[model samples]
Target: MSAAGSSTESARRVAVITGASSGIGAAAAYALAQAGWDVVLGARRLERLQEVAEATGGRAIALDVTDQASVDNFASQIERADLLVNNAGGAKGLERFLDTDMEHWEWMYNTNVLGTVRMTKALLPKLRASGDGLIINIGSKAGLDPYENGSGYNAAKFGLKALTRVLRIEEIADGHPVRVTEIDPGRVATDFSLVRFDGDQKRADAVYADKLNLSAADIAEAIRWVASLPPHMNIDTMNIMPRDQA
Candidate 1:
């Protein structure tokens, strides 16, 4: 933890980000910190997470969003949070529906959908208390478009999209100032393909070998922009894609 992480600087809004070990989550933490927001990073990889925390002058806490106990413990450590970026999600396999693997489906649903639910439910109170809270969910283009051999990931992201929408409606209906936004990125070049292919470097390389892909920083910029908006303004959903991606 850095001095900023320990400071009683109540004026600097705190943003809690999950999956902050790398990629969009880590980038968002840096972007927000640079913009004067205190960041609290959470991820399963404590070492990598701490590196990001150190760079951002934020605190790092071990967190596995797919685990209920982990989410609870993470929530307990956060003293304040004006923004929550639910970014811990990814694809597992690329098998077709007929050859569906339940394990892949389970992992996808647990991490992408239920993980957000667990984190949101645990920290909703703190968010409500903030008076100007915002929840930004990192969804994917897979959720909005159906493609071959993407059953598990597509379904998981689609479920996340539904959750984002319903949560937004409920918050509004309940008269809470908490804002919800979903950022669906088309194709961001990250370790996402490597993990999905289970560390097959060749397979991962092919994902962006001959195509224009968005960088993690691109999505991170979007997250920062949404959080920087006025409390009264709610950007329900933002679909960010590379120019060549239709």
Candidate 2:
């Protein structure tokens, strides 16, 4: 490639997305790529991640967000990151606060809350250097409205909401160019239920069956839209829910 061509390619905005192996993450990767943003995908499942990368013409790197070493390695591979989508999180189980197992809570907190912290910490420098950086944290409506039998997941998402807000405030106070936004979705039809139910396909299917539910692609569109907006604009939080869902 000529120097100009290389420069143009380098100038194209690049986005990094976690949990890109499947669900909303994968859809977001495709949507961003379709919108002319170069995307880098990361997930623990390398094969699935590679498939999405291939389909979207993006790069895939194996990443386990819950692990600090993995997060470090993932960050080191990226040369530039104008957008970072922290989507690598899920619920383990649904139980009442009284019946909740500490193990589930630990997993939820580590993956949903600490995982975002690790990724944001690792990539903040690159984002700041980009001059126009954006970080989109995938949160859940459960964070705002707690429900029965969802203590662990609710707490984790609530924590994420708090973290996202604080990060935005800090960036403003520090006069950094980086922008922070949280996309809090109510219910998207994805493998989230399967993971939460521990591979119980029936239960997972039942969650969305005969009910109006959002799709991963729906959330991906929101992500793409948010990233495509002018740098001067910052959407602090967006809550997406199906029309039928109150």
Candidate 3:
């Protein structure tokens, strides 16, 4: 990756992506690496993160987004970053509010809500230093419309959308060139449901059994496009889903 604010014309840009061990985060890391951006990956699973980093020829760091010290240290290690992809989050289960475990609710709140904020806060300095920074928050369609038994997950995403909107405005007002973008995608065939169900393969597979689903590559491409835009251009928001999905 190029040094921060260097004058070399052909210097490669740097991108930092969280949750880069698998799913959309991994796909985006590979895509960015291939696009000539030096990438730094962060995730809880060190082995998986190492695998993706080696495959993409990028750097990897073990990160637990819920932990403040970890996030702070990771931010300090990044000297320059033109893009920050906040993609670390997941649901717990499909259960009514009254039936859900309080621990599940706490877990969702910690990772999905506070985790994003911690990353953004920690990275803002480096992002601002780059002079052409982009922040992409991976939201979900559930944020737009809450479904039965999806109260906790939906609430976190909805808060994320609001957070992005506010950050966009604040950054602009502060004369920072940082751009915030949100990509709210519908259901995709990923380890998302599997983790939510605590490794119930049968139940996870059932979510996409009869329908065409989005791949991690799909969302990765969208993120790449948003990050590749001209300095004067910004893709503020995008929502993508499979054709069969409504």
Cα lDDT listed for each candidate: 0.92, 0.93, 0.90
Off by over 4 Å in 1: 1-8
Candidate 3 residues lying further than 4 Å off, grouped into runs, are 1-10
lDDT by residue for model 1 (132-169), tens: 89999999999999899998999999999999999999
Query: By summed lDDT, which 10 consecutive residues of candidate 2 come out lowest?
Result: 1-10
Least well predicted 10-residue stretch by lDDT in candidate 3 = 1-10
Clashes of 2: 0
Per-residue accuracy of model 3 over 17-92 as CA lDDT, tens digit each? 9999999999999888777788999999999999999999999998999999999888888888889999999999
The TM-score-based order of candidates, best leading, equals 2, 1, 3
Using all chains and alpha carbons, the TM-scores for the candidates as numbered come to: 0.96, 0.96, 0.95
Cα RMSD of predicted structure 3: 2.6
| C-alpha lDDT of candidate 1 relative to the true structure | 0.92
Check candidate 2 and list the clashing pairs. Answer: none
Q: Clash pairs of candidate 1?
A: none
Q: Is candidate 1 or candidate 3 better by TM-score?
A: 1
- Candidate 2 residues lying further than 4 Å off, grouped into runs, are 1-7
Instruction: Give the TM-score (vs. native) of candidate 2.
Output: 0.96
